[model samples]
Target: MNKRLLSLLICLCLFISVFAGCSDEDTKKETEETTNEITSETSGKTEPVVERGTLKSFGIVPDDYVSFSAKMFDILGLDTKEDIYVYNVPQEAKVIYIEAYSFDGSGWKNVWDSGAGITAPSHMSGEIAIEIKKDYSLKISGDYFSSTTKPLTLSENIENVTVLKLDDFWEFELDKEVPVYMILADEEKNEFSYNLEDYPSTENLDGVDIAQVLTIEFSSEPL
Candidate 1:
């Protein structure tokens, strides 16, 4: 009887050891799976991937460099003495988007956008520019007009238009004091004019009723 009881106890002990080992392995596997799930969830919340494109494709050139903060200007080796002017802007304009680019030795690289973080080399090849877009709503004489204006294209000689966002409005800080023309179009009349002064004072049927030219002036303050 004693031998039989000892044999039974030894078998029970072996069974319990096998079951405990299986439980430990299952617990460890569950913990690893939980950790992996958390890691995947965290990775899903990472920053968005920035888009890459060429400067020419986006119609950006070195002369399009506008004034950033004073620190950014210093970093890009820009001449701060030139007057910056954004011409032909509407009476009320708000910047809706901004795109930044940097030039390395070989080519111009899109470095940043308005909401994304900037990515660039430690040193650039002295070329940088920012493209700004503003809201198209025009308010005139306590009335609002819904008009579509064509995209602005800067001339090769026209430069030094630094746009900054200040209190929900776009502010132009001029460096070279150049005249920048904002070409506006009247879709209803199917006419576009850059120089309103060129037209005669005589009243005509096809006169521009919606477009007006505005020149913004700013003090020589460091951005």
Candidate 2:
């Protein structure tokens, strides 16, 4: 009887030891997994920085509007009413100029120039509203001013056309009823003009490739 009791106690001790060993191993594995997760969450993943003088380009489709703050327009010497300019610029352009152009059936003519010498900020870059008039393309020249404005064609075409949000004009209240000209252009570079007072109603510009747009001559009197 004594021998059997001793044998039973030994078997119980062995089972308890094996169970404890398995529990310890599981705990250790769980701890290791948690540690790995924490390490991954707090480890090295950073964004690369862009150097100055790097050239970049952006595209704007009709009906889509971009936004920029008033301070930036101030640097460009523009008195934007909505306190926002409808265009995108380089985060840090060495030189920047916004111009309005009219594409005659033959060539593009400069209508308004938003004098250059404006540099953009890296962190808080503003937005641009893409609005195009009938035959106008807003030309933003700077950064690679000479090259970018050069048309995308290898045929030595030079036309960096951009559009603006029309709401920018509708919301723009002048000191008086000013004579404004809305310039619009199309894909073939054909240009046209419209009077701001008789502004055309905004239409669903779905299949319209209206290039750049600009509003020139906000005059208290007639232009």
Candidate 3:
């Protein structure tokens, strides 16, 4: 009986030893997995950073801004209200050139713009432009307007056109009635215009396209 008891004790000790070894292995694996997870988290935090931008415009609007938009039609002998101007804000990484041409009302002509230098904290570097031109007049003498004064003229091609974000235009106020012409050109020089009309409106502009609003004329004539 004494020898049998001693044999049982030996068996129990061996079983405990095997279980303890397995537990140790499991603990080690858990620790390794935890360390790997921490390393991955740290790497994610240090990823590369890139800059972002919002809607933007050229300001201070040149002192002659209004006059410039109107002159586009005068040169063509067209006494019409089709005047356009274009400008852009380029991303530091992608800007090649910027230009502007306008007729504010008095006459028609072209103006070379090296471009305006304005900055907005919320705006990233990108290109956007504007155009205004005169529409068809009743008399033939007034019918043929300047290239830019033609209703719906694009200073830049569609792919080259610049777009604006709502946040970007909030930085400036509409001091006067302004016609914001966002135009696009096709292969035959055909162009389309979207209005970002500013001043005297009581509609929701939240998330609205400023370019689209400017091109549409609201009729007060009443339907």
Candidate 4:
């Protein structure tokens, strides 16, 4: 073969190799971006979606009320507020309380409690003003007098008690003497009275699917 022809062929091959290398790099970059997108969606880190500019109004709902978890503010890239108001609480509920806490080096430190100012009866509207500093955690709680009940105490007879399941035909055993009056509420928030002293252990819930038990209280006091 001619030397010139041979040299020309070698240069062409080198050019093709370079072109193939560039294409592979581009393909690899595209694949990486696609993978990242999938990962973000699956991992619950997708871009936040809001209804119009509603959330942009700082969740200050008008006739209707909206509540924001602390993380919601962070996701929106807004400056943390020193105070926030909760609106549109259920009318049936008697008390609305907001708690603010700051995370210390070790644990959460209670910073503010709305209960100090907002009391029952007059504050039944469920609207509350919570004072919080930047980087503080906030929690809102409301209680309806009718729905308020006590948490049943663990009977000593049942040494090993575990909340096997919630609101289901869960399995639990009773055997011990309870000093405090026990209260149990069903799924519909209907109260059921149980006292080991009055009721016999043989009170057969045999066929009953222990499910639908919303809460059980040992003492009559609300928890």
The model with the greatest lDDT is 2
Task: Give candidates' CA RMSD values in order.
Answer: 20.6, 17.7, 21.1, 17.5
Tens digits of lDDT, candidate 4, 32-121: 999988898788522322343233221122112234454476468665432233232223333223332322334334444343222344
Model 4, position 21: C-alpha lDDT score: 100
Residue lDDT tens for model 2, 18-115: 99999999999999999988987897532222224221222111111222333355458875422223222333333333444444334445545553
Error of 3 at 128 (Å): 31
- Candidate 3 local distance difference test against the native: 0.33
* lDDT of candidates 1 onward, in order: 0.33, 0.37, 0.33, 0.33
Better of 1 and 2 by lDDT: 2
For candidate 1, list the clashing residue pairs, or say none: 70-223, 82-175, 82-176, 83-174, 83-175, 83-176, 83-177, 84-174, 84-175
Clashing pairs in 4: 151-217, 151-218, 152-216, 152-217, 152-218, 153-218, 168-211, 169-211
Stretches of model 4 off by over 4 angstroms after superposition: 46-97, 100-112, 115-223
The number of clashing residue pairs in model 2 is: 29
1-223: candidate 3 lDDT, tens digit per residue: 9999999999999999999999999999999999988897876533222123222353212212334433454456664432222222333312122222333233212333222223342232322333332331111111112122233334433333333212212212222223333322233322324223432232322222112223211111212
Encode model 1's per-residue lDDT on 1-223: one tens digit a residue: 9999999999999999999999999999999999988997987533221123112121112222332454366578776432222122221222212223222333324443222111222111112222224442211110111122233344444323323211111223332121122223332534343243332222332333332222223223322
